[model samples]
Target: MFSRIDRYRWSFQDSHLPEVTLFAGENVAFDQRAVRELRQMLEVQGTMNRWSSHAPEAFPEGAGLQKVVLTPDFHKAKGIPVGTVVQTRGFLLPQAVGNDVGCGMRLHTTSLTAEQVLGHQKALIPKLRRMFFEAGRNIPMNRLQREALLREGLLGLMDTTPRSLQEGLWQLFHDQDLTHEAEHTESLGSRRARNTLGLEDFLGQRDFTRDGQIGSLGGGNHFVEIQRVKNILHPGIAHAWGLRKDQVVVMVHSGSVSVGYTCASMIREHLSRLYPAGLVHPRNQLYPVPNAEVHEETVLQNWDALNAGCNFATANRLMLALMVRAVFQDLEMPTDFPLLYDATHNMIWEEDGTYIHRKGATPARGFEAMQNTPFRFTGEPVLVPGSMGTSSFVLAGLGLREALSSASHGAGRVLSRGQAMQGSTQDLDDLLRQHRVVTPVDFARTRPDVAREKLKELLQEAPDAYKNIQAIMETLQGAQIAQPVAELEPLITVKG
Candidate 1:
């Protein structure tokens, strides 16, 4: 157990962001699309209001079953909105878990520092370019290797990119790290979901699932960031989390892999038809389905499948880290090698027999159990990677917040990626160059105005786009949400 921090009550208060209401109100006119979604959402929300009025006991003693603190980065998502959290009695909504099951962020440090990286940056770019192509030819494995993969990109299909060889890489990985207990913890590379019928059936419906989806990043908000540890608030906590001031680290933020897309795509269709006609209960209608078993089985399978993809993504970063590490190794870079401080932005959890849906939030636990292990939390360090091109943070769970001990997934999203590409790349270029961040992957990297415009759009995702980290930590201070240790800012970013 840890010492309680501070108390801050959270009751349903006035809306902070404009053009949004907590519940249906009579203040402003509604857009057709907004009205449609609201009308439908309220049908379930209204029922919840009545049920809570009648059965307040459904909510825990003190929790009162608050939905979620939708921060500025809030947006529409699979079932629950992106920032939503569901603490329930006996149900799990698959949509709240989203398609990319177990999508999260992982941060690790290599024995490389800013100056050392500066020396080898150009030489490393070509190798960095090669890493993308390396996934295809050299990696082995066919279907079996693909099942356990969690990174959404590697499992199903890919856009312009090549299929991911991560599954093969995962199998071969153990051949080298025989001494390390890498496989004992959560498997980084294995395959399961693609082999299942549920996933298969789901993928059949959406051609996109079967299309070139392997080894690609999730569309919308998921991204990867290279950040510098701006500061450390608690050095003891920071050391426990393997962090140091001025340390440069790679933050890979991704989720669920392709199988999740298959599962969610299929399940969503079933629910869309089931609602308004089937046994749409007051509480279960918005995200309706048969029993929790069927869908839970679907998502659970997705969990296994996505984890495989994520494992491969981890492998991708591990190799990438090795590349960075190797370069720094030559330069005698002054930094730490990366360990697992994974921030899973989208995933689901089984807590006390209830489905704690973390739409775009990190699943946090305590550090006592995870300390000195790969997971430096009570379970493992929950990575709360800030927005792309911004700060990323390391969080350890206290696991006391009964509303299902969780925290905001990240600096969420103020605008979509499409919106970001609209702005000037110039501003983004200046900012990136000024910050020493590099965007060599894609998306108008050389064009300044194009990148700047894009940056401005993503500015919607800037620090201002999120709940003030201090405020969020303080508000949930005593609630056992997550404890902060160190802060990481962007240095070199790869946006896929």
Candidate 2:
């Protein structure tokens, strides 16, 4: 039997539920359909309960979560609900951090104008394809990465696995200088039991080191978009970012893909074991294991792996950009190629060596801010990607607002991939056309199931599905921890 706690319009019937409370105020309201959808997306809801903020230990003395803000796009994800900003006293949840480890948008605007792209696209298609193909062929992995155990393979990707797979092994044999900063996983949120989310389990679902994942836009919401730098929200900021309206820019969004799934899968097992047979909760918030100190070594190992995984994620985009650049050169487009910003959505950081978990959120750093070393910075850029056929915003961090200096990761998904695939194909196609988006390949190009899965994610993430970003910006007016640099509009979308 489990101890029960009750609260108004909510209850901590589940132990885990007691750990969290949706701060839905009078303005916050959800229809039954939305509620049902959210509950379903929260895959583990049946095992957890809900409570208000005033409830017991949910809001500990010092949690990064000073406030919980949900937009119209709010939905459920691994453990924490998407759009949920959590500030824990001292911990991080790998699931909340998300599967696409270090998955964030990187935007680059060039000096070219629109006439050049529209005129040369016919000549540009082959070049773009070749770029992706070649990048898919060669992706670099460091020594530590060689050993991390997370790589990928597509059925097409798998058959063509490059000899690079053995390069890591060869390096070790040759005694080369390929060392990496290991990932540390121990933290206030880590459970005492072994983390099932280790790379040992999920590494090979796809291999970037090989030909499997490189140049490949993996399944689900990830995409590479060709956008027009249509607007500069803040002139001063835009100048700093080197962006100009009407210029062409490219945006790439992807994460650890299958590798991340395995890491989180392993951790889920740990959470399951942490809960005793008789113990039950309305919810299943990540239960950090006891004897956390002892797990420090293991935690560091996991953290290092996660960090390197982040490096992999970065390399993923870099390789793709190299292709984009090659495409531009092939078409002789005048657009320049420069990495504006690189950020990660799923991550845990040390604030002065303390733990900070950021899930479905990005850092909203300002020009000057002090965040414990390795952290103190004038500000960091925040990449906010919108729906594939919509607009993406670029902002610089201010500092801390509610808790951690943070902002929503994207238009938080409102539906699950399964739910998103429900609309008619024609309707989705029409929507894209209306948005002026030209997908590189049509729906037929994707596996029926994979296409549906992506559609589901797209539906949940459609521009209409998110809160008006401009309104969000208005809400944060003066809270300019992140000054708007540019407003990017999508032209072409490549989703795999």
Candidate 3:
């Protein structure tokens, strides 16, 4: 059973596992199955004695679970819940980060106004589809550039790609712009990668290659939406972030698709190989790699794989933003899309000495953790995207230690995929029209069969599938976890 510990937090405790605190409102329902799975996963900690542990001098604290916290948008995922945060010492849980490593949100404040972008909506929608869905995106990268990006993230791209190569869509890779943009991004929006699994083709040739994943938004709730500032909750902070009333902003929600999946597969396979010969596998198929002398090498390799996928995901989001910029340029809008911030919701972060694994949860670091970045005074820009056709928000992290300095990634799903699919197609279409959202699927020219298939797919992510964004925001504020800087209303949404 769960009890309301406070206005912002609900507490659940099992005798066999650590207590889980969820930051949510009174209206949100708690998933008991997720809590049970979490307890079961934690119970495996007792079985660590089965594996031989050489006293790793490197990790003095050894390996053990430390804390578990759930964000306001917490929901049941496969084995772990989305919007969950787990902190551990001297160990790394591969399943904690899951397969979608580096999946996150990116926001860019544009020079154009709502009036300017909306006025051209009729003419701009097709252009956006052509650039995003069609083969109109021209991003050229040689093997060196590709390897650099996969190995070292955006910094690697800037260091290796020359001025001459930065043409067409590549022009957005200006050194100055990248440098400035990095200053605002979380952890500088990059991580050094040592392994490039399943990326041989893109890394074999010396000349430019046309890779499909770089600029593509992968499936399942990933989107690029154009929004206008709906309200200023914190004028001082909003102004600092260059947000104003009715100003247009572009938000991209995506992740490392094939690259992340491949990397995850390789890492999990290695874990399986390391498993002791006569032991039964964990029922949930989740494995945790302890920081021991015997497992140190494997841990390093796992980190390398994780970092590679993360770098690829970061680069992927960057390319998506540039694609949007290219579309605007094609329509004669000024190419002044300054990046507000880029932050990952799914990844592991090493803080001080503990490892914090966040799945569908964003880092809401306060001033101290962000002292060196442009957000030093305002704290990290926590981008919480709402559901399709709902109001999203930009919040400033307050760095609450009790909450492990984290916030929700988006409005959590209210209905399961199966339940959402059962809704009427007409209601889905009506929601899309009511919000003025544009999708790549052109129903006007497509055959009835094709349109039905597409509509079926889109119905799963309808706005009604998510919780109330206003309630979520209220919890965040009431909890003192993060303060809202501004609210964004969708102008046009581009779903993949």
- Best TM-score among the predictions, by candidate number: 3
Q: TM-score of each candidate?
A: 0.67, 0.68, 0.96
- Give the C-alpha lDDT of model 2: 0.51
* Pick by lDDT: 2 or 3, better one: 3
Sorted on lDDT, highest at the top, how do the candidates line up? 3, 2, 1
- Which runs of model 1 end up more than 4 angstroms from their true locations? 1-8, 13-79, 125-138, 148-195, 198-215, 270-285, 290-338, 367-379, 414-426, 440-480
Candidate lDDT (C-alpha), each: 0.47, 0.51, 0.82
- Residue 157 CA error for candidate 2 (Å)? 22
Off by over 4 Å in 2: 1-73, 125-210, 269-285, 352-354, 370-378, 415-419, 433-462, 478-481
Q: List the lowest-lDDT window of 10 residues for candidate 1.
A: 21-30
List where candidate 3 sits over 4 angstroms from the true fold.
Answer: 49-62
lDDT of 1 at 28: 13
User: How big is the positional error of residue 244 in model 2, measured in Å on the Cα after superposition?
Assistant: 1.4
Task: Write one digit per residue (lDDT tens) for candidate 3, span 37-139.
Answer: 6666665565454443432342435567778899988887877888899988777887788889899999999889999988988888888888888787888
Q: Judged by lDDT against the true structure, how good is candidate 3?
A: 0.82
Q: If both were scored by TM-score, which would come out higher, candidate 1 or candidate 3?
A: 3
